[model samples]
Target: MIRSTLFFALALTSFSALSQSTLQDSTHIDLQPVSVKVYFAPQSLMSITSSTQVVGPKTLTAQGSQTLVSALNTVPGIRMEERSPGSYRLAMRGSLIRSPFGIRNTKIYVDDFALTDAGGNTYLNLLDPLGIQSIHVLKGPDGSLFGANSGGVIRIQPKGFDALENQVQLQVTGGSYGLFQEQLSVQRKVSDRYQFSFDHSFLRSDGYRENTALNKKTLQTSHQWQVSKIQQLRLFALYTDLKYNTPGGLTLSQYEANPRAARPAAGKIPGAAEQQAGIYNKTLFGGLSNALQLTESLSHHIALYGSYTDFKNPFITNFEKRIERNLGVRTYFSYAKPEAAMPWQMQLGYEGALGWNKIDNYDNLAGVAGKQQAMDNLDNRQWNLFYRAQVELLKNWNLEGSLGLNKNSIHYKQRFPEVNNPTGDIKFDAVWMPRMATSYQLNRLMALRASIAKGYSAPTLAEVRSSNRSINTDLAAERGTNYEIGYKFKTANNRFIADLAAYTYTMKDGIVRALDENGAEFFSNAGEMKQRGLELGTWLTLLEPRNFGFVRELTVQAALAYNHYRFGDYRVANKDYSKNKITAVPDWVNTNVVHLEFPQKLTLHLFHNYTSSLPLDDGNTVFAKKYNVLQAKLNWNTTLTKNTAINLFFGADNIFNEKYSLGNDINAFGGRYFNAAPMRNYYAGVRFDLK
Candidate 1:
């Protein structure tokens, strides 16, 4: 099977090159640098004082990745892992200690709307890359603008809304393990002042392991209206329905015996397959944003958003269901004067959210609900106010400062098993965070920057009222201060670009996850932990398009990360774990991409990813070994007519067929921690566009 797949890829590559060479004339494509827009401010990448990265549409289209992890692995200081077809987890700067199944400690936004809820949980997996135009990532903690996060911030912009043109697109893809997907999109400009777009997608996959199938569908619509010359309104709506089966983790012995088998029944508990454990979720989200120019030097922006979620899960132990509703509002004002002797900018913002949840649990009688076990009602609220100021101190130097106040509170009430009436309310003290940064431009091609910021992360609703049918009212919010310095450089001809950053952070009241004997998950506060890391990214153009024999353009991009994370002070069951390596954090991670473009609109991309060994438990007695994977993709684009185009692509992953675990269950009982990733996979896709 592997040989046949390789042969097919080679044949397609050869055919694309031959056809391109015969059909098109030799023409040079312009290679120019682009500017980055961070926090609604547009500037050159080399001039930005913060550590950030941008992934553009060209890269996304060339790679044709199915998940965000595949497209974002090129960014330094970021890690994404998938346990199953639809389960995703992300970590930044070695902050995965608190995250086990979803995105936490990170703020996420789409356009002007927030994707994170009041309880600090972000549903990033609900978005499909087909509708995304670009992604901007801020590397370290920045609680000045974004609220209550220790990791960082991510902003995603949709395609049609930014293009402002009339177009239609269709795409289809099929790959190994019964993977298939279809997408359709339409955008139209009704008038000079109004624009609208709609997108729909369907995806399904029969995963590598038993009971690991997935089905997902999504619909999204967006509209923009220029009310007047200096006023505008934007609206967005989204709907997603997803279902995915879960294959529980296996012990090392089980993994070696059969990596494809589901978790087996043990003692009084049933097996994962027997219980038909899986997740079913239906969600709807919408937002409205408005911007007004109060004066030549002042502007105001406001956004109102809401979301609803219906979630159902059938597990080995119980059948759980939840109905969740959330509403939020965000407003900000900015004043800028660039014409003055010393340019200055200032901003003030307020953000607030309210959430309500109704949860019910019942006995899982072979995937069917039996007797009612428990019922609960939860209410969560969060609010934050922030202020920022920036000034040009000298011709080549700048200074920035920011401050924020954050408040969080949660209330819980139990309805079932009311005899004892387990009810509680917890409120955290308001926190004040401050940040300062400075940048000095050494000529036009190079810059030096440094920053210090305070960070805070509150426990999620799931962590407080856990799946183990227990409420942890004593859990406290984690606090930390991060220090960082960075250097950025670019050549005058834009042939080379490089960025390097070093940072350290010490956190108190850290949260960690653990599994009980029956495989139930719970969280506890680890006393303290310290993290230090270095990140480096570089892009070099070895050769530009010319009369080169067959290669039109050749470029190489690479990112490297080095992490040193350890427990500063921690103890469990009278045993000290101080100085032990942090769980699930690798010592080193590196990624490289090589791009080669041919004359006939044909391109080839080679990718390499490497990760060092990491500990799986707090005791540091078990570890996951290191692994390396190589992948390649080939793409060809043909302009059939003046207004129509077609694209063909093929790719292969895990070309070496190495067996490794992509995600692990931390501190699991009975040593059932391994979840094996797929060995080797191949995919092919095609796209059609009309204008």
Candidate 2:
């Protein structure tokens, strides 16, 4: 695999070199300045003193539209994995030790709404790729403004805010393994003050392995209205019905025998196929945001949102049902004095959430719910107050600082033959998080930055009440501090762009996952961890765009992440595993992308990923092998009429047919850790746009 990856890298380098020579006299790449909103305000990328990456439409379209795993992996310091067709897991600047299924320890936002609930869980899989316009990733802990999170933050911008034209679009797609998808979208502008967009999509697939099928439907809409010259209102809504099968993990011997087979019956336990092991989720979410400019230099913004979810899971061990509801509000005030001798800005904000969860667990009798085993009702509340300020001095130096105070508590009542009828509220002590950063513009093409921040994350509801059917009141929250330095550079002609960053994070009382003899999972606090890493990104434009030339444009981009993570002061049950490598964290990862545009409006996109091996257990007794994956796509776009356009695209994934496990079950009791990913697959699609 390493040899193959090296050869592929060298080939691409040679091709890029040839193209650069051939187009030596062509105009330099005409790149544009980029901006981000991680600070609740727009800031130039070149001047921000933080590690951030942005992904736009071109990056999303380079791969298949089925999932965001491949596209998101192209960014350094990020890892996205899929266990099956619809199950996803995300990690940034940290190991995936605490999360076995969903997203945790990270904050996420869509438009003006917080997707991460009060329980610290995000349903990222329920979102359709077509509904997303762009993504901005903030690496490392940023709890000063975004609340409790130790991993990172992801902000998603929905589709409607990108344009203001009235239009209609339809798309149809089909692929191997009985995959089918359809999407429809419409946007209308009633007047200059109001506009709205609506989108609907359906997707289904017969997965590569048995008992791994998927079906999903989505509906989404967004509206923007300028009520007055100094006021604006925005509303967003989304609904998704998603269902997917879960193929249980396999032992080494079972995996070697037949990688495509689902987990078979072990001893007297039932198999996944017989028990109908899968997930069924139905959710509805809506939010309204208002912005009012009270004075020339003062403004206020507020958002109100609510969501409900009906979730069900039938596994070999038990059948679980949950009814969850969440409500939240976010409001902030800002003051700016840019025209003063010394420009400055200040913002103050508050975010809070209230959540209720009713959970029931029952025996699984041939895909049916049987005798109740456990039941619990939990009420959770969390809130954060934050303040940020920025100042400019000496015409080239910028200084910034922020702080947040957070508090969380949960109360629960147990039913169904419960020993404890009611449990007192478990309250976590208030914590303070602070951040300081500085940036200096050395020249027109170079910048230098440094920052230090603190992060804190409380235990989620899932961790508090795990599958072991016990409430672990002793579980402690994790805390960490990160120090980072970065540099940014670009050429005068905008043909080359490069960014480099290095950081070290020290965390105490880190949460880790464990399993019982029956395969039920639990969580506990470990001793400590020391994580150090470096990230690099480079983009070069070989050929500029020209309508009269045969070769319209060509560009190549590469990103790399290197990690040296290790356990410190760690000891568990007579085991002294200190100084061992962290579990499920690779030593290095690299991704590359190439885009070429030809005459006749034809384009080709190529993607490659190489990941190094990593340990699967805390003791470093088992390891997963390294692997490489390659994908490609070809698209042809043309104008069918003066008011209409058509686009046709075909793509293939895993072009080399590498056998690997996308998501591994950590610390399994019986060495059932391997979940095989799909082999080579192909897909084709057509789209039409009407204006």
The pairs that clash in candidate 1 are none
Q: Which candidate is the best by TM-score?
A: 2
Candidate 2 lDDT by residue in tens digits, 624-645: 8888888999999999999999
Clashing pairs in 2: none
Task: Write down the worst ten-residue block by lDDT for model 2.
Answer: 24-33
Root-mean-square deviation of candidate 2? 2.1
- Report the Cα lDDT for candidate 1: 0.83
The prediction achieving the highest lDDT against the true structure is 2
Residue 646 displacement (Å), model 1: 1.1
Cand. 2 TM to true fold: 0.96
For model 1, residues 252-317, the per-residue Cα lDDT tens digits are 999999998888899999988998888898999999999999999999999999999998889889
Error of 1 at 290 (Å): 0.3
Model 2: CA > 4 A from native: 1-33, 548-550
